[model samples]
Target: MTPSSALKAESPSALETISRNPRIRIRRSGPPAEDAKCVVYWMQRAERAVDNPALDVAIDVANELDLPIVVFFSAISNFPSANLRHYVFLNQGLRDIEADLAERGISFIVRRPPKNSLEALLTELRAAMVIGDENPCREPERWRSVLAHRLKIPYWTVDADVLVPSGLFPKHYFALHIFRPKLYAHFPTYLVKPENPKPVRQWQRPPNFESFDVKEDLTEGWKHLDRTVQPVDYLTGGTHAALKRLKDFVANDLAHYQDRRNHPEKAGTSHLSPYLHFGHIGPLTIALAVDQALKQKVITKEAYDAFIGEVIGWRELAVNFVKYVPAYDSIDCAEPWAQKTLREHARDKRDPVYTLEQLEKAETYDELWNASQMQMVKFGWMHNYMRMYWAKKILEWSQSPAIAFENAVYLNDRYELDGRDPNGYAGIAWAIAGVHDRPWFDRPIFGTIRYMSAASTGKKFNSKLYIRNVMENEPPPLLT
Candidate 1:
């Protein structure tokens, strides 16, 4: 913020501050319908009712128009690579929103497509306007654009999930150093904890257009939904679960976060990626909790800074990556230097080129790489350090950079709970195509792209224990 606009940001009154804030972007025509009933909040990316900028804007606008707000969420069976596991977790989150909204005298309705649609629901409810949350990914972005063109009434979206509203930064950031100062400089205006407000008038249930039960399996009858990948048992969805995990991490594991975060054998890192990806928790909520922990002298500043740098820095950087870069999810998104270097050595020969099936079946010769794959398959997550190693090895084993990108994206999206996300895409690009990373020593297949030797990376952590965990959780044939 400039010296002229550096006012002390009010924490409790954060919602009010964001009423006409830069975080909001108008998608459709303005001037809400004069003879309309309720305001519909098209809950998309940010699923939670707490500490959500999107929900805050809906309430603020509804209050101004003297109308009750109705939150409408639609669950489509085929969301790119979404499967049964992803739907289950999403359904759990919808239930959480249902209960949370009830407490605040708001309403939540979950609908499906073909028969049930957002436009139909809005028309039935006679909605004055619509407030939605933002998603930078290609498909979701296209969804919002399509919806905006369809809706006649005022439609706007808030960059709810990200701490820094992605719209503010218009360019693609090459590295953290280039993006760090620019992001932090605007934190004064955007980074405070958002106080989610209740609607001024409670939602009045209409006589028609019934909503699906949140407790039931919404994707049960949809054959298009992939049921091959079953939901894992280790993690539960919902904002309450996210908060519990956050509190536990801050109280117990944060002190050792810096030291043990890279060790795959230990649970030192805050396993909040799934929650963050699903919008079960807001970034500000986690940030404020960590800052308070630091203030209480529970964790050292070094640990605090390190955690923030990884969780906050790298995350928003990925968001910026997806927001600006058109081909973010492909090998075409790699830097020019990386592209040239990789192409120069494209035909150098992959000694043990494994097909997608072999990699998916975890039949790789490298024990540690196989363990990382197993971790993602069995646990729906992999250690951050191992993920880097995992992707780098795919590059070493694939025919070309484009092929590596395809295989990595396929496995990552198919297994991990937080798959099909900016972070996952950026991570794969970094490991395989060198998106955010600097060029390193030239190699045969990898070229200037960074290389992670399995032998060297294994020495950094307890690979034996990690492999043991995978073996115990995975089927016996997985290791062979």
Candidate 2:
């Protein structure tokens, strides 16, 4: 069968275009395996069937090699800091993946751990080559590094999650001013969606090949898995759900996004962070939607600028942070000034130092902070303005700055649906250690790091109404 016109990229040679693209990182240097069965897409980060450059690359490679392509998603129960809330949403996305892949004539195989690692499954399938999506988080990056050392066949991974590939910037940008110009410089070239071409040959699953039932509980029997973080119904997972949310945001809230995003009491911001974290939705998808809305005069220029500033500017800055900063999740990731200032304030008195347990339980003197914690714990999400205030309060109250960072990370990773993401890590670092922030007048505990007072933060928004809204959302189990 001939390749469709849509499959043909700008360059005559699709292979050259893909291989030379900055987004595609060649993990293993080798040619396709001899007597290869098929091309495998080790879908992990970019889990969606549409607008996923990783899957597109795999399909392109399979078409170029004249072989079918199969998608291999590891529904491992042991993903670090992941829990029942995360898995339930992930599994929902998997259902959409299977359904979507079937329409494209691609075979979707859902696998579990113990015997079903990417290496084991790819080898079992006699894969010619493997393509994967990028995840900048420490554990996942380390997994890729180990696989690069261990895999015999060629492997390539696409930075499918971010609008701009993190590879463009070799090092972390200390501030958004430096990163924003660089981001927009390449936006015209990189912000467009992938071709999403279908494979020339549909994948044929070999005899004896096994996959877990799509409807079965992927987390079942994993005793170590944290089931305490129950799933929330307000924000369901999957590409369909993500797209719906984007549509709703554009239609209903985007026009007023600029005014209301900072106000926690209003439903102004797009609540798509969980979907973005889970890779059910890609940044390109959301950015394009917002851009389209702007062009169509559906939203004001100020609103568009404000929303894009967060999505493309600050969000990609976080991606760059985790990719380049070795100690991204800790106080060490802070700038030199931030580090020095923190050291100077090491002995600063913390009047009401809170233990990790106390912080986790939201038993703090600050009522606004307590409301934010309850919001995160009860709904698996929180308002961004509150997140900053929440982290700053932790720094002000914890035994030490390092302890504050550690406790913040533990809580962020433990409760929030978007925890364990670059944004979360970067947010924590910013709040505690001033990673992407500039130093302010020297202050207690926080030193020169920007201090967010609860009173001022609450004043900026409807603090009372926000607290009431959070409480009214649901009957929180542990909160009064």
TM-score of each: 0.94, 0.94
What's the CA RMSD for each of the models?
Answer: 4.9, 4.6
Clashes of each: 0, 0
lDDT of 1 at 69: 95
Candidate 2 stretches with Cα past 4 Å from truth are 1-14, 474-480
What's model 2's lDDT at 346? 92
Q: For residues 131-186, what per-residue lDDT tens digits would candidate 2 score against the true structure? A: 98899988899999999899988778889998888888888788999889989998
Clashing pairs in 2: none
- Candidate 1 residue pairs in backbone clash: none
